[model samples]
Target: MGAVLGLLVVAAGCARQVPPDLVAGAPATTQAGTPAGDIAVQVLRRYLGTPSENSFPERAFPTVYVMDHTFGDAADPSGKQAGGAPIPAATQQRIAEALAPATKVVFVADRETVLEHKESCARVKDDAILITLGPPVGDARRVTVGVNGFVACLGATWLTYVVQYQSGDGWQVTGTTGSMSIA
Candidate 1:
């Protein structure tokens, strides 16, 4: 048990932290000192790294609402992800069994924003998104991509993912999702 705990600590320590750009009083600014675009990419990458083949829903769900900036809104007040029933232990074990080859994927930030759009749904006042991290990403990029999922970066983990995109404009993210943990 002590060995396992030590390993977990060492693995968690591997997380990378990159200083984020801050512009206070600016709604477009990154939150908690982390860039939204970077966060999106990091989450996407971690998900891909995991064994399970949880895929992102087809972009078929068109979201017409776009704002000039992006932000993170706690979907769960305590920041716990809800709605999806608890994953079964057996299923998790199966996922761990079918691990995919580790590969690096890159995403660039083309445009990101947060907006409330009422044109799409009426049940709520408007559609709300915590953040929108987009990169003008496509097939031409050097890094490879596969089915997406989430990775658990437990306690105090910080991630810095940089993607080299066109026009020499690179992208970066510097934090971990608080809820991304298997324990």
Candidate 2:
């Protein structure tokens, strides 16, 4: 038994352990510090490493648009995203306010303006990340919300996600409906 234990120790010492895949520099999250804001941050965290044009960067933040709502809102001028549940007004305000400090969370209200502003996206260093939040419905301990992270630049890219979060705990990405890029 002693010899076997000694052999196990030797083998363990010979094995090499790999370090966790840490972000090279500061971790970049969309966290705005509010309950919903933090939830959005978690959503962004989940999307960061996925296959996308602007994959996760070695940074602490990314500028994203904070729209009026998701699923069904005037944010999309085409009206295809209409007839969906709207995010509560108070909740939207809270998220926008919380996110303002870390990034420029704009509410352009229409797709035309979004496109218009796209011209200066590179100049201003904006990633064109539009975060349209859905109605955050939940009880005291848990909540679920819809979020769309759309990029108007690079021929456009988008991901519509539903996130469920436990109050005072971690986040859960409930859904990733679809993604598309024009070019």
Candidate 3:
């Protein structure tokens, strides 16, 4: 198992960086089949690379799992409200339901979708997830989930993660502080 995991990591390293110029005219998109957990890390790296920027690069598909930022509590805080009113607790809770350890994380297993190199890689272009944890603004929270061969990150850090196509919003489940493993 260790050898296999190591090999997967080594193989991932082979993916090679996509130069800015090539990112647009590249012959292919990032192939799927990568563990959801691995894709989760890429999401983090994306957020870390550029803070306060919202993007939904479809090419980053199969990577449906997202880790972005918002402003709200476990259940509708001031940040996640309408007309300045906090969002309903039930709605907020429902959104965070994925935080449970028992929650199942889904992935896009469609080989065709995964391999389609010419697919339109558009941004999320919506305000779907609009909540995070703790005080508004600088007060960030770190939400994580681990289950069903997947993991995620959530918090003031601007990350909203969810298993691809699976119902229910992303969760804020807890796991090792910095421990990691590959599927």
lDDT of 3 by residue, 31-50 (tens): 33222222233333333233
- How far in Å is the alpha carbon of 80 misplaced in model 1? 16
**Global lDDT of each candidate:** 0.23, 0.40, 0.23
Error of 1 at 174 (Å): 8.2
Tens-digit lDDT track for model 1 on 1-183? 000011111143542211121112222213233332332344344433332222223311112111121222111222222121121233223222333233222211222222223244212112211212212111122211111112111111112123333333433222232232121
Worst lDDT 10-window in candidate 2: 1-10
TM-score leader: 2
- Candidate 1: stretches off by over 4 Å: 1-56, 61-63, 69-169, 172-176, 180-183
If ranked by lDDT, best first, what sequence of candidates would result?
2, 3, 1
The estimated TM-scores of all candidates read 0.22, 0.46, 0.18
How many clashes does each candidate structure show, in the order listed?
5, 0, 17
| Residue-pair clashes, model 3 | 17
